[model samples]
Target: MPEKPPAIESFKESTKSPESELSPEVLEKVMNKVQDINEAGVAYSFVSGGPYSAGSIFEQDNLQKTKLVRILKEGLLGTPEKFYLEGVPPTKEQWAKEAQVSLRKGGRSNVYFNVTGMAHEEETPNTQSGETWISKSAGSSKKNALAFIFDLSKFTYDDDTNKMSRKYYETYYKRSTRKFTTAYGFNLSHRVPPRFFNGILLKLQDNYQYDQLAAEIGILSEQVYKEKGNLLLPIYDVYGNLYWPKKMSYEEVKKFVEERDKNKE
Candidate 1:
């Protein structure tokens, strides 16, 4: 455990008195939770107000996330009254209609479902760009919808899990407008690759050599960046981005082929 860093203290202060401020009680809970993390020796960093995000926070360990989830669920959502519940749950037909409307308006994706175990997709409104058809079951309960709200940014692989996670979490049902406002939260997870390197790697995709070298290279790359305070044998585009080369390095390409052959070993 270490003393609270100056940056972390500043973050706590800013959250306490921000333009869109949290309540004193909530702020205290947040500060305490952050202190607990620091005391537990968890490594973390925070980024605020990205275009697609409110805040982007990263931690070294998954345990930190599990602990934070419990704290937020109990602290911010302490009372049953803070949430909305349906006594007589909506009918399946009503749920489907709501889901279809939501999918149509989502813009970047289509909706898919299985009928007699055969998959079918509802077409996207705009097809100029690639759209993925994400299948989800209709929400039957508030708790289910809350769980969906919690996992909105998570990418689940299992069909059942993905379906459950993608279900809409309806917030306000405007009678006059005949519309539902859905609520969701975002978390930036560890699974995403680093910001700069992915495009180059994507071009060499399906090459086993590239996969092995990339897996082994990340640590080595970080060490070089830290010790020398410079990039390794730099190549950059007009925008000074690593992605500018527009081709995999010859050394990496050769190693990629070599590694592919050895994978048969």
Candidate 2:
């Protein structure tokens, strides 16, 4: 594996330290488990602190978020207790609740995969924003994320799930007391176009298959350019950034792929 680039090393250092401020034993276990997941080339992000969010982290001040937040605060949370549970499973009722969240958030439908993992999310009476951690589930969907909330005092999270709902591993620094929300970690439904998928790939050193998936990123990018224009190009860099003037067409990309493949000869 290549040495950590200076940029990524700095990023890792900042996020890993203060976030690891949890108790020594818990922190050790958390990092070790995350490392194991990293080594396994699992598609996941180790997130800490920020707004509670779900789905694409694009767009802001969305009116569609009220349902998930309301349900989380006032709906079906079970009683909290000493030391929390070692592990808990989701009930069918909770799954149905997720579907409702989907509709409220402008999604066409809801789908659930069996999942397992821990997460935390919270909203406070006095504060403008909240935070969460939606773990990647080891189950069918791969990365089941967590949601969390912290008032001036208490901190708590929701059970992780794979179904496409919002508030997955979200966190926020400052939002409006009057309106809006922020997302801390990753947006699960967020995906890069095929062409740039390879370009923005993560966890490559851990597995060769990662290369296979990303090797065609250029092709995917071309496809997106043809059909969707530059709508999602910024996903590779940052939100609202386009590396190229506009997306390229499929035929143009196909020719580029053929030319690149021939160059290996």
Candidate 3:
């Protein structure tokens, strides 16, 4: 482990608000649920930003960085995997369509999956400039491996109003208040297999602003967990190294997260 960064240290101090600011009952309930899941023998892993048009793990804002650290302290284990997309940016409509498909399939579809390969440069006639147009082919063939994919459409400000289903909060949290203000949403991408699934630590941008920690922490209570019975929470470290069940057992990973938290304290 490396030294905790100064920005994260500042974040820790700043987040120490009085508990009375929020509903203590709700806070305690969320904490209890989190404790129960942590002891339920569920496996855990970390996933940073996945295939986004903007921002990488290393370039995350303070809020995002703080959220990653806070979740790690809460007990998620392993190095965080950093995912990125290649080629031209997709339109908002395209992303919305993909989100619908991802929700329907309960994971990422193969349409978004990218295989490792090299970029091929090519030139063509430019009608406007009367010069050769240069561009690189999106597909590659150097190496064949799985790259993590997530629905970026949900994260954009345009989708903030209608994208996040209020039914989730109404059913799980039992609160009608729209806790999430920003368009940001969080979840495990389709990259993780079904067998090793545990749970997800979901958070939106305005989630922290409203200090809706309980709603954010209540992801395990979702219906998907009931159906799957195995959903691993994806986490990310400051260094952005990805970890999964293939590299460590659930017990080992859990212990690692707990120990790391203790040391930080």
The candidate that wins on TM-score is 3
In model 1, which regions exceed 4 Å deviation?
Answer: 1-49, 52-246, 249-264
Candidate 3 lDDT, 164-246, residue by residue in tens: 34221111112222222111212222223333223332222221221233223223223233443223333221111112211
Worst 10 residues of 3 by lDDT: 133-142
**Please, what are the lDDT tens digits per residue for candidate 2 over residues 1-265?**
1212112122222221222223454333222211111111122231111232223111264221332222222322321221013222233355345446645665523111111112222321111111111112221122212222111111112245354444332212122123111222223322111222111212222222222222233233334344433221211111111112212222333354466556658
Q: Considering lDDT, where higher is better, how would the candidates rank from best to worst? A: 3, 2, 1
Question: What C-alpha lDDT do the candidate models reach, one value each?
Answer: 0.22, 0.24, 0.26
Clashes per model (N, Cα, C within 3 A): 0, 39, 15
Q: Can you tell me which runs of candidate 2 are displaced by over 4 Å?
A: 1-98, 101-170, 175-201, 206-213, 232-265
Task: Give the runs in model 3 whose Cα sits over 4 Å from its true position.
Answer: 1-17, 36-40, 49-83, 86-96, 99-265
Candidate 1 per-residue C-alpha lDDT over 33-111 given as tens digits, one digit per residue, 9 for 90 to 100: 1111101111111111112111111234333233223322221111111111321222334434544554455421112
RMSD of 3: 19.3
> What shift in Å separates residue 265 of candidate 1 from its native position after superposition?
1.9
